[model samples]
Target: MLTRWRWFIAVAAACALPSAAQACSCERPSGDLHTQLRTARENAVAIYRARVTAVDPAAFDGKAAVEVLEVFKGPVKPGERLDLPSGGRGACTIAFKAGKEYLMYAQGKDATSVSLCSRTHSVTPGTESELAWLRTGKLPPLPVALQREAVSCEPCDIDLVGGRLIVAPDESPSSWLWPPQAAEAMKEGRPFFTRAHVDSEHSLIVGMSFDGKPFELTQTHEYAAPSACTRRIHLRWCKRLDVTTPAGSPHPVFKCIEPGESSLQCDESKGRESSWRPPESIPADACLWRTSDTALCTLEPRMRLLPAGARASPVLKCRPQDLDRRDRNHFCQVETKPGPTDKAP
Candidate 1:
């Protein structure tokens, strides 16, 4: 009787497992690459190589999946090759260069680039454009560690997918203005900047000594993504109210404000002002994980957390056992090196 009961329990537990294949939806957990593709295909995601037969901005509502006909374009000339991401149902069309390969994703409400797999092989010129591409090169192993570097006591998450590295979500605010050094500079009646002396938004706050020379920094903060975990951020430094230079330009002399980037000019003609604002919803001098604020994570169907320091730190905040497991049934192994596709000729 005991044996019979044991057998019954085993059978019930086995049946509880979810299907190996499922659609890419919110309910689904972020999964391995094979699973992502399977579900994406079901959602009508496909790759294509066609000419610019026509265009419809409103097709997928703002997320049009354009089609570039094979007729012609610069590098990707007629009969050559090209790539595009699509909804596969013809509901939307994303734009691609006259003739080139592009990886597309189903960006959410706003317009954003879909996550493309750098590890997957490049799509053939004529395949569907919306289809996700995979990276073909070798990849490092899953992070072996995670750690905390910030003082607020907030921790960062990191993730490894199909051998790709990712940082976790960021919810910190810039309200922690005036790190230690910035505070001291103010008290000394010296000319000091709020951030690190690196840039005006310098992670290091800077202050002037009695002789108007540079001295001690109150704090050091690395600029990162604001909210999403994909976009990298840009930083700047300033010696005066409106005059700011790139992180590493001559500043001690401070004769004239020389803006390095053409896009960023101290154009007194445009009115001298430098209260830096993020291109998107980001704050100055903070870390960001995502590439574009309007962009979405396309590599996986669901979101995954990338713990801080998992790439190299000795400690990890997220428990190791807490790390989940997926079936080996799909996707190639995370490779630090690769074996040939076929045995020796």
Candidate 2:
């Protein structure tokens, strides 16, 4: 009876075991090569092309010494030697071999590691597209169906599709307001405005000039991302506002205004400007219109602006996930007309 009980217990224990152990799984990177590269660059602490100099043989304790050949992103310089983790004895870790060059997307507390789950891979024919981008910063061309076409409009030429305004990098005066590198890219005709997600109800307005009397252009300022805590004393939050400058010009078009404190003061009267009045709505046909108290507007009656609810197009059905996953404030999906072969009988 005891022997029979022991046999039964062993059988029960064996039955309790899982049919198969779970293996490592990784979520595939979304979007095209351009998007993948952008995502990797934003997430990884350091990115570079490097050749492995040495590697640890121990499967559990994998490590590699690599000589940096090129610094694509981050503070690491070329010719710098770095010790990075070789994806160990698991399916998720990268297998780093000595003498092999790799485009590594390194991420960790110190940015000294690689994983098979990342875009990191050996430099080969398979990785030529990535290498080309790293070397010359050229992006892969869009599909023929999704290619952007120029749309002529007043003030600036834009691509208005599905009610979203696609501004050319060169046409944006704000692009010239950026640092020298961005200004140079604008000059080179490389795309600066990759993506935007403007609301269908709203219109994007850029570059307006008065025909008659010369009116003083308002001196506008662009602010940097505000710090969590601006100051240590009152913990007053503040943002750094930089004066807008013209293309290739060092001098600011407007006088630099002193940075102001946040409206967290005890006196409410001081926070509100008494001279400020509610903005009056201007006619749609006028050279300019008041969309809001703080937004710029332009006249585009020829485009025949559609109502918000009627803005949906059958050709362009963008999913919520696609819109949510995008890393931009404004986004516009391309519309594709049905091909001759796609038509039903």
Candidate 3:
């Protein structure tokens, strides 16, 4: 149930990874370069084919992002969280509230409430018709225990194993998911929040609101039970990504998303640190960024490739293709067509 800003422009280009996070089951301090490879071989991740039934406008915030729904996986309810392998806000948000919705808009430097989704679909970054959503469906399927309760918090605990760190909410935040769970008897299909109370230790569950916090509870030791055996949950982090895990340690996890196509190809760039080639699924004119060193990439928009040896070297050394197409004479123009939507004008 994560969200972020999106570009509406229609150009053919790839985005550079802004930063990264570690979401893989095989996250470790030493890390494994062959982890994704091995995971794919064992079908650790499933690649599903989906088309853009619809898309809402996108907005950018300095922090996280949010988007609307056009087409989606399963019947997305209100407030349900949705994400693609590329790692950005979703097109089909779980609606502000079931049927209620909002538009993505930039609030100065942060991507915050700008407007609500129009009664009639409005113009947006990508063509609503051609927008294709890419994400892992039920990557870690939820346990049946969570589906039974309408208001519940699936445990979001992290544990380290096999030289890697594995972090997942008990059943994946059953009560407070952005797009909400796919289907269940009791489901609070809305974005979850962190509600804190100083005076009263009591916390109330509520729907998503830009102005009001979601589920705020005092940070006191409410469930102070004696430690049952000491279990350590090791984590990894890309200090560069600007993201911190609740757990003391941090890690980097990347998701490759390509719009309107199958098979995400995240090829490591020949000469760059944590950089790679944009797969064939994203758009040419899409705005994307990696908030952490452990982020992801989504390629799309009719293959705006390197025109048969356009230029071998990168202008910005692993930056957005639009900005780093080291073709010199055409460098500035590279990022011209499909730069980030929030890119400073």
Candidate 4:
């Protein structure tokens, strides 16, 4: 009865796919290692530890004969040799070598097909935990303490602040990504060592870490800002007011502040005098980035922050607005309040 239910689930998942083209595109396998094992066990028609006795290499398709050592699922008796569909040129192809052992997950009763995408892999010490769970149905316990090894990411040409790349991709020095393991270390903020690249005028970022993992960055005009709204200008007044500071100094900066009500309007001067208009109500969920203290704010939810040594432009861009109303207002309030510089001291 349990076998029948598992078979039904596999069939249902296949049927639910939109088209045959998406048949192999499984939803990202979720859960921890143990949970994933349970899923694979329930989904597979045959799960066994097998020794590849023979392999027939042919054009387009390959076949292998395996002698079952242990049967986790299916009715195949131990020592029974079965011919399995083994390899192909496609993305799902898995290679099987004669005389080597593997933990195999095969589908179909009469003619089994094994894929690289399945839990099948050569027997190794790394798979001991998974194999133990499959045989005993016990989840592995977490270690009391995890020891982290520092990843030596040698300095690239790019300037870094607080272990973060301080230069933008456009103006960054030659930068490279660490290897998969080393990259994981970098993401976890582990210390890595590498030689720094000489500062160059090149603005494009492209390279790989000493471990040979390629890091690619595409340069664009758009700035990637954080989710926090660092600055906000309130346009609460009904009429546009242009109060120039110090009378005139080429271009005077003006700001309109109103109490309580949140108005998204009041056309202010950006850099030079251009035009003025009444405000409009900004959407409740608007993500806006300020071009400058006095310039109009733009919607840039995915904008990146300005890195060190970035080319100075006339209009300065601020962070995007927060999603939560309270958080947005709280952050905006701090920014709007006068600082020590504004005081008499």
Model 4: per-residue lDDT, tens digit, 101-135?
88887654532656645666777664565678778
Model 4 Cα displacement at 255 (Å)? 73
The worst-scoring run of ten residues by lDDT in candidate 2 lies at 219-228
Q: Which regions of candidate 4 fall more than 4 Å away from where they truly are? A: 1-27, 108-111, 142-345
Name the lDDT value of residue 66 in candidate 4. 89
Cα lDDT of model 3 by residue, 1-345, tens digit? 123322211000111111212111211111121222223223322221222233342211112222334322223333433431221222212222223332222112222222211111123432132122122221221111000001111222211121011113243233332112211111333233311111111111122222221211112111111111111222222111111222321222121122122221111222222223331222222212211111122222234444443432212112222222231111011111222222121
TM-score of decoy 3 = 0.17
Compute the lDDT of residue 69 as modeled in candidate 3: 41
Q: Per-residue lDDT for 84 in model 2?
A: 77
Of 1 and 4, the candidate ahead on lDDT is 4
Which candidate number has the best lDDT?
4
Say which prediction, candidate 2 or candidate 4, comes out ahead on lDDT: 4
- lDDT for model 2: 0.37
Model 3: lowest-lDDT 10 consecutive positions: 142-151
Reference-based TM-score of each model: 0.25, 0.35, 0.17, 0.36
Decoy 4 TM-score against native: 0.36
